[model samples]
Target: MKAMLPESVRATGADILLGNTYHLMLRPTAERIARLGGLHGFMNWDRPILTDSGGFQVMSLADLRKLTEEGVSFKSHIDGSKHMLSPERSMEIQRLLGSDIVMCFDECPALPAERAQIAESMRLSMRWAQRSRDAFGDRPGHALFGIQQGGLEQDLRAESAEALRGIGFDGYAIGGLAVGEGQEAMFGCLDYAPDQLPSDKPRYLMGVGKPDDIVGAVKRGVDMMDCVLPSRSGRTGQAWTRRGPVAIKNARHADDPRPLDETCTCPACTGYSRAYLHHVFRAGEMISGMLLTWHNLHYFQELMSGMRAAIASGTFEAWEAEFHAQRALGDIERV
Candidate 1:
């Protein structure tokens, strides 16, 4: 996977990639990765890499995570080993990984919780953000981003944004959304969230969504976003395009000889047919994942590029109109 990523990203024109702190720590540990020359060398990808603080995984992936004033204590899902992740420790881990962009350690409360509960969690995350800033100290050319958490409350989001601004950071991330909040509610929060952060710094929407979600967020002034949908869906026989998602594993594609997307230049779409892709996926061939993943990433990057160009040319509204128009046409009829 690592060997193919660099080439795939290059083809997609992606400038950065995100690495999961929790998963990497569970496998190789931060110290071990540092001894082996950090994640850049380990992954063999020299491009900029952003590492999350593992706080989210501590809440979601760990077996019995206990949150406290300092941090969270939990057991590894992989080996059942106990571990603790504090703001300082999270900073240290990202540093050891030699990440270009490091995220602040912030607690994320699941949605549908009481507003009071979310407020308390947001306050705790703010305190941890200060600690993370102190521990990160000075790292030339490296960035530390503060995550704004407030569940769905606008006032609390403003408060969190103010706290992050007071602590100062190279960038700001809108966290705690997309945890189950549907796109409508997420967009409602985003309508005001991005404006709360400093206009000079980049605003990132964390764990954001599908093609439409990205377009909506970008329209709201979010400068960055990260999601596993493209790659994950690709591995599951899904393909995203201008017209919508294509379920390549369906029987309708069994005898289809067309490419996944005629407009896509990726290998899966340009060098192979839908029938061939369907056969490989049904056979559980590893190449199916590789090809589909490549295509998905390529399409996402193309979408991003189109958005960027549209924004620069001051034609984003028209571009978005056309985007929706195309999707309204739906996927091509099954051959």
Candidate 2:
């Protein structure tokens, strides 16, 4: 996490960072972080930090995780220790971390679930959302976001949204779409998901996606998104550009003299050539990941900024058209 940010700081010039409640809780424990002067001091990030409730990770990564009416029980992925994560426990963990934005604990089941299973999951999450809200009590300057999970079914999503609206939250997140579902299906879901929730609240999309995916989601009314793809792909030699993604290790770029993307203002684009980037990545140089990660994150932030500006100016349609056109053509050689 520390390594991912310094490059991001240089590229996108982001002021704040996100922390994972589940990851931190597994290692240092939120209590320890609070005793050490809260997450801000513990992580050395003075700016606002948003912590996820760990629901996704608990279901996705942990083995032997059992779900019941009370909560989820599982063995720690880091260690073999047993633990239970309930709504109350999740709220206490976030509170201890002193996060500026906290997410409500909700179940996120894998896609293609039976209608009965999806309905049950949605109802359980709603019940847990109430518990999370109740446990959090009241805290000023701190925000709680509720996750709406109903798979790709429109009716289920609406039901989840209605339940969340009744419970009340600072923000609403559209969950359970980006998990192996194609862009078209995801977009179809997003078409109604944002409108189903309150317009005044910020809408977040979880575990989303490629550069094009981000642009499309934003155009469809998503305000925020999170993904490990950019950073993870950077470490593996993938560079995401406005044109498209370029696998840096491809032999075609072995002697290319131009930067990754001429439109990119990232240090890697302005300061380094594709040939050099390819060489570093092929040679297993540590700086390769740092540089490419910086570029990818910069690209993502630029997309976000462009969308925000377009929305404010009411030119999102035109901007989205250009966004789609740019990616339609593969990255051309920069002379």
Best by lDDT: 1
Off by over 4 Å in 1: 1-3
Query: What is candidate 2's CA lDDT for residue 40?
Result: 86
Each model's TM-score?
0.98, 0.95
Tens-digit per-residue lDDT, 38-79, candidate 1: 998998788899999999989895348888898999988887
List model 2 lDDT by residue over 208-252, tens digit each.
888878877887788888888878888999998888889999988
lDDT of 1: 0.91
Q: Could you tell me the lDDT of residue 92 within candidate 2?
A: 95
Model 1 alpha-carbon miss at residue 245, Å = 0.4
- Please give the TM-score that candidate 2 achieves against the real structure: 0.95
Runs with alpha carbons beyond 4 Å of true place in candidate 2: 5-11, 333-335
Residue 165 error, candidate 1, Å: 0.8
Query: Candidate 2 has which clashing residue pairs, if any?
Result: none
